[model samples]
Target: NMIEDSEEDTHERYEVEILSKENRRIPAEMVVESIECRGEPGKLVIIRDLTREKQAEKELKDTQTFFEKIIDAIAEPVMVIENDFRVKLLNNAARELLPGNSETPFLCYKISHGRDTPCEGKEHPCPLVEVRNSGKPEVVEHVHQTNGKERYVEIVASPFFDSDGNFVGIIESMRDITERKHAEEAIKKYAKELEEVNRLKDTFLDIMHHDLLNPLGTAMGYLDLLMDTEDQEIKSELEVVNRNISRAIDLIESATRLSKLQSKNSLELEDINLREIVDRCIENFSYEASKAGMKIENRITQPISVKANKIIEEVFSNLISNAIKYASEGTKVIIEAEEKENSLRIKVKDFGKGIKDSSKQEIFERFRRKEKRSIKGSGLGLAIASRIVELHSGKIWVEDNPEGGAVFVVEIPKK
Candidate 1:
């Protein structure tokens, strides 16, 4: 009976071995004997699938490395804070912005103020608290002093959330706007100086034009008397002189008007019918257009109105006259107006040689001319026009026309 029982037990053990081998499972007997000798019986002996576990571990390591790289790569100072306002993570940029003794923990709020007092217990809590409570990003602009240098920093704080939709903490970013602020201030100062210089120039021109008028009038009177005498050769010479003097006087007057328009000053506003203003401009330039053998066409239909100064007339006159001067003889110049939702758009189209793209940006600047030096112009027309448009709270730009030419469009607010 004992021999038979041993045979049966051996058969059962062989069956178990066959099953384990088929499934590629580790043999229990190999591990069990070693474990039995140890004191701890409840200890776990896990045979993990090394392939999957190693892949997961490598992926986790890669994610951590990527996060660290991103944090270090940011140019602005970044800090991560916990709900209790303790510093959790800070980048290299933050350390450089607020460096101190290695033994001391770098507290951002405290270091920003350069105060010895802790930010947590101070009279004014850290601004980040407001951002956390409001659940929205908050921005504050202030001057910060560090290492005996003052800088303007714009602090931005935004709330962070976890995967479970719990409020985790806040991420704070600080940027130095000192250089941009300084540049803006310098521009304003320069604009003021230019304004003063322009005023002085206008005053000088006015005085000179006024002084020249008296002698020019006397010359005109003497030339008229010479014409009355009818000495053919002398009369012809006097007529030429008279014509040249008239041209000079016209130039002086135009310059005076342009100086007034280009002055860095505000305009007196009144609600006026824009159509009527455009009509008067067309009429003023009609004779000049005829002399140039150019035809003027108006496409404006409705009565568009805007709050503007009387200088709008001069602006259009100068633009139309330029269109006439540069266009081919007998080419048509079209003035069109359309009413926009909040603004009035007026366009002056000329079939002249279109300006090059390189020169378009600088054409509105003072003393810029596309024509050759021989072209009789002081190069102040477009500059004066731009200044007048600015005073009227308007914008002007140039674009290429579909039909081989250029279009100058002026947009002014309706109200």
Candidate 2:
């Protein structure tokens, strides 16, 4: 065939297979030229083996196919886009996202966005264009409309380079984040509703404080005058009434305080002496402790300054009062402090009934108290203490004392 083609065209080249000694087919390239050698008309032929070249070509194709299959197996849509906004290569997921009728050298913007030009804007910024311009990777969020349904997609565009380290284009991995976006929007809406609900609750509490507490105060004043009449039975009856009125007042005041503390986001902090605060709380509760046949052991005598506000005193006061109220008669309530690397750990331990493991966590929530009915409380005290400690970036928890009691621990930042 090469000799016949050389006779017509004077020169020809053919790629053909020839049989080897072992009868195996071998690929070869042959060149045939019509020539006059030694004054005779003949064809000059030259043959070159092509088995290695063919093998190399097949290996390259197989490598490309292997990587293409790996890319297609990925869940997220992947595309290799050229600098001209053309889709050079794509995976199966990308093919599903792109147009089915898209031809070779597909324009990415046209196939993906149904647009004639590249995407450009603050909201729908083009990550491909950014990568091309900056020669760096970029991540961007895009809202795509397909079949009249909006889809949120996060595109991670990375710079693609050839084997020679020359910049080629960008490889983009597109992840569908529509569900996550919807969830975030729902959370924001729920948060707004909760904020409004809290505002209404605060308003209602304020109204109750004004309308209920003022009249109760006036009634107490009348009772005080009535008790001065010097009638024994009447005086005892008024004393009971006075005690009930004071309890009602305390409940109302505690609720108001807890409400205010819950509504606050931050506090004005200062350098306060923890030892002084604890001592003052002990002094304030000393008479009550003595009346209950208990003594408060203050082990925090040394000057220890902590970053907190005046309200921190309320934490210690509540703990000590609670200890005296619950501890056995003649038992000592110990107030101790241990300085930490970045904070202080203060423990108010009482030789009383310890908190149950089941109710230990529940006790910190508002209106959730685990105590006997004889223990008169508004159930807002511990909740208020928890909120104040939270405001100071502190933590409070209860533990069982080694000597058969409860130990309330509070940790607060030193600085």
Backbone Cα, N, C clashes tallied per candidate:
0, 0
314-411 per-residue lDDT for model 1 (tens digits):
77887787888776443888989977889998999988788788887688877687774333455677877888898888998888877867888888
Q: Whose TM-score is greatest here?
A: 2
| Every model: Cα RMSD to truth | 11.4, 3.5
Judging by lDDT against the true structure, name the best candidate: 2
How far off is residue 210 in model 1, in Å?
A: 2.0
Q: Give the Å shift of residue 288 in candidate 2.
A: 2.6
In model 2, how large is the Cα lDDT of residue 362? 91
Q: After superposing candidate 1 on the true structure, give the runs of residues whose Cα lies further than 4 Å from its correct spot.
A: 1-203, 227-244, 328-330, 359-363, 369-378
| Clashing residue pairs found in predicted model 1 | none
Give a tens-digit lDDT track for model 2, residues 255-364.
99998897799999999988999988999988988888898998877899888999999998988988887665528899899889999999999988788999999988
